[model samples]
Target: MQNNLPTRKIIHVDMDAFYASVAQMDNPELKGKAIAVGGAGARGVISAASYEARMFGVRSAMSGRLAIKLCPELIFVKTNFERYKEISKQIRNIFLDYTDLVEPLSLDEAYLDVTVNKIGMPSATLLAQTIRTRIYNEVGLTASAGISINKFIAKIASDYNKPNGQKTVNPEDVLQFLEELDIKKFYGVGKVTAEKMYQRGIFTGKDLKLKSLDYLNEHFGKSGYFYYQVVRGIHNSEVKPNRIRKSLAAERTFSENLSSEIFMLEKLEQIAEEVSKRLNKNKVAGKTITLKIKYSDFTLQTRSKTIPYFVSEKAIILETAKDLLYQDTLSNSVRLLGISLSNLNTDSKNTKTEEKKVINVQLKFEF
Candidate 1:
């Protein structure tokens, strides 16, 4: 059974509007300007929208047309996923130096369990502070962090202070802090859910906690259990640094949509090369091959086929993706390509991919 137990020290690190921030870092002119990624023309979906654009109600996943309506001056740029991935690797390396418990939520955010670490640090709060400072100093970008006793609380804490800010919560003050927070701010509680809670007089953690477990479970099937412990500042989600490559996958968005078959094949070759590199790094292979295609209209579809045994070689992955690509007729222009690997073995391949795993983040803190 899972519980919302607290960690001795847990921290959440989230980048500030990650993609937009990266753009700002590379070009100073983009800073404080309304910016977005993708085309402003028809059928363009935003990959990221800057804070300046957000102020005008623009957002990621919003169509480029609507974003333009909100902020006419929005500057659209092409996606440079490889560059972002490289930066993510650099940041991950820095986190690993401090502790092995680093669980990446995505390319831009991660949870860490640093209760007992390499440096024998005495305070998790101090460690979280140092990590935030180091990322800014070393990476030349701003990051925000949240430190608390559990993943639930820590994740929320990190968001309270954004764009290079850090927040800490002491155990003794947990209830009071939670009581004052708007119920809508509770983890996983969105607008519609909050409205329901408000009608039921569930306006705060205290209100939420007052409901019987049976009642909450009755109303919210599985997620109710999540709410129970969170109100009390307890969570038990592990900071799993080592997740065996369940599915070997690689993805890249083009600088622009590929309109010609020659350009499409070139992009596929690049992606295949990347998949091959990951396979060699992981030292694992799979019989199953999957090809993911994203069209210029932002509609995505995938195709997959499995082969016998596992493989971790570059040549094999490319051959498989190449074979998969032409298996279907091409009608629409493509904007993104992805390859994945699964079913790996340690003994039959390179020894590099097999290693002990480290946790990324822990939950719960003294302050």
Candidate 2:
């Protein structure tokens, strides 16, 4: 395992149930109630759910109908993007006071590199506490923070305490903290990937670290290398302030599943048009066209074609999507359809170079 590694003070700040909290903050009646932010219509999906709602298994991206089935007392509230954006701006301003090297993952979450911050604070733990305190005092909403030597660990540490709390993983404790972490808790490992790891007997970081690099590659493909390196604490990605958008997409979930391809053509056309519109609005075009299919049983599959040139026209997008749709047989009745564009002209030219086998870093500072 790689012991010597570069260290930088990184903090991941995530607002606790941002959307649902905002609704509760704005409306007195919603306080301490099980609420989800979305429409209660047949085709509606929950954007966010309060902790109370979560106790009943209501979660974001879940259908509103299912959410109601899970919690009969769940209140559905309409989304207020204007209010969210306004509050986000306020929170961002607080981050700016400490560091300009802020990488926003979303409106509610961000990674802050405070190795060399504006306030010249020596302790990242103190910085996180102060930042969270200010956010609560000024914005009237609580946030959670995770502080560590790198962004990867910081992001995971932030979720340890949860809902208005903070966790700091000192450099000395980084390895042990990661080793003890559940495989599912690793940042990039989702439900599907976690299941795959479990099938391979990789239940934790310690189990993953025991595997050879070639063994991981053979089993997990490109991601296997990432798993091997991260288990050894070798993440070297710097906190980039101007994180570029890699892809753009639009999707729709139907109230009723459509079985035939003929019934899907119109939906595909609409989706393609939406994708084209978003690409144009972003002033970018992509060479890759991907069609995402989500079946009624919640199984998802994607088909993609990368052309020689980037195209943002709806006609071109729709034609490509049509080709992909006909390329495969229907797996099951489709409930959702989506179109996404990648390999965009705006993609970064810089590539990540491999880190050395071992490198020394100053890790004596306070976490």
Candidate 3:
């Protein structure tokens, strides 16, 4: 059955320590130093950390205080999104020169379908190398590239060699590559999921491949089928250029946990305002408002409500968020609060043909 799948030439490009690297690139004195990009205040969060800082266990999203504790000499730089956005555009243009199908995951990473490119190049490996070199020469930053037959493998391959490196998985090597890979590295498999898999004696792709589709579905819900096919190198998802923004969100972690519901409400108001502002800036409205709460114990939960009409106003967003927040009793003192607007009214076209396709699953963990 796997042999019947259509092959694609996919490349995943990721900028190494993007924000922090960009800072170091701009300032010669900062090169080779342990630096981070984010707020430097006591309550601030680290957005990105240079490789040198990462060596000391400092990481993005860690509190500024904790980051400093990890690397005493770490220099913190405020984020300049404007500059990052401009550089992102420059790198994207380099992609466009090769192929029209470029899907940006963020300012630092993107997926490119080079199965049919403008340069009439046949070797995706060389094309990836050319793209990475172009970015370094033209944009003054290094990028890692991964070439494979699908987005899933390409994404994982890109991470295999960090900083300035590239990896390619030939069509015949996909199955062997995946079978030997750790289940925890399979994109969407989070720590909780990985633990569950371990307890079930499913610790690697080979272990996962042993389960029947029914068994997987019973255990992992809708995502079960995704794991079933991806482990066998059967992904066919296309790189969608100009993808619509599906949701807008804003969240903040407090320096101190808030046990009072009143304090939680106040924080929710600020988050809701930020969400509303982002929705308006994007010129989009949504019917669904979701509230995410992270307890002090690190447990997380979300509550969502769908209204009849689209809304992007702060008043409506705040009202809806407040209602959802009160729908359930507080489980514990919360350390973080977030608001998100989804079910957006953005026009998007289905560009893929009728074929078995797999969506690239990137799991995000928050602390």
Q: Which residue pairs of candidate 2 clash?
A: none
Q: Candidate 1's error at 113, in angstroms?
A: 1.4
User: 1-367 in candidate 1: lDDT tens per residue?
Assistant: 1233334577889988888888988999999899997746766779887888889998998878888888888999888999899989988988888889899988999988778778878677888888878888998788889887667778888989887898887666667777777888887898888998898899988899899988888887797888876786666677778655567687877767787877777777787788888877766667778989889887888888888877767677777888888898766988888988665554324245545433334443345
What is the Cα-based lDDT of residue 91 in candidate 3?
97
RMSD of 2: 2.9
lDDT against the true structure, each candidate: 0.79, 0.91, 0.89
TM-scores, all candidates, are 0.69, 0.91, 0.90
**How many pairs in model 2 have backbone atoms within 3 A of each other, for residues 3 or more apart or on separate chains, i.e. clashes?**
0
Residue range with the least summed lDDT across 10 consecutive positions in model 1: 357-366
lDDT of 3: 0.89
Candidate 2 TM-score to native: 0.91
Report the lDDT tens digits of candidate 3 across residue range 1-367: 2556767888999999999989998998999999999849877888999999999999987888899998999999989999999999999999999999999999999999888789988889999999999999999999998998889999999999998999999887889999999999998899999999999999899999999999999999999999999999988777889778888999988888899989988888898888888888889999888999999888999999989888999999998888988898989999899999888887343233455555443322110
Model 2 per-residue lDDT tens digits across residues 51-77 = 999999999999898999999999999
- Against the true structure, what is every candidate's RMSD? 6.4, 2.9, 5.6
Assess candidate 1 and give its lDDT: 0.79
After superposition, the stretches of candidate 2 with alpha carbons farther than 4 Å from their true spots are 1-3, 260-263, 349-364
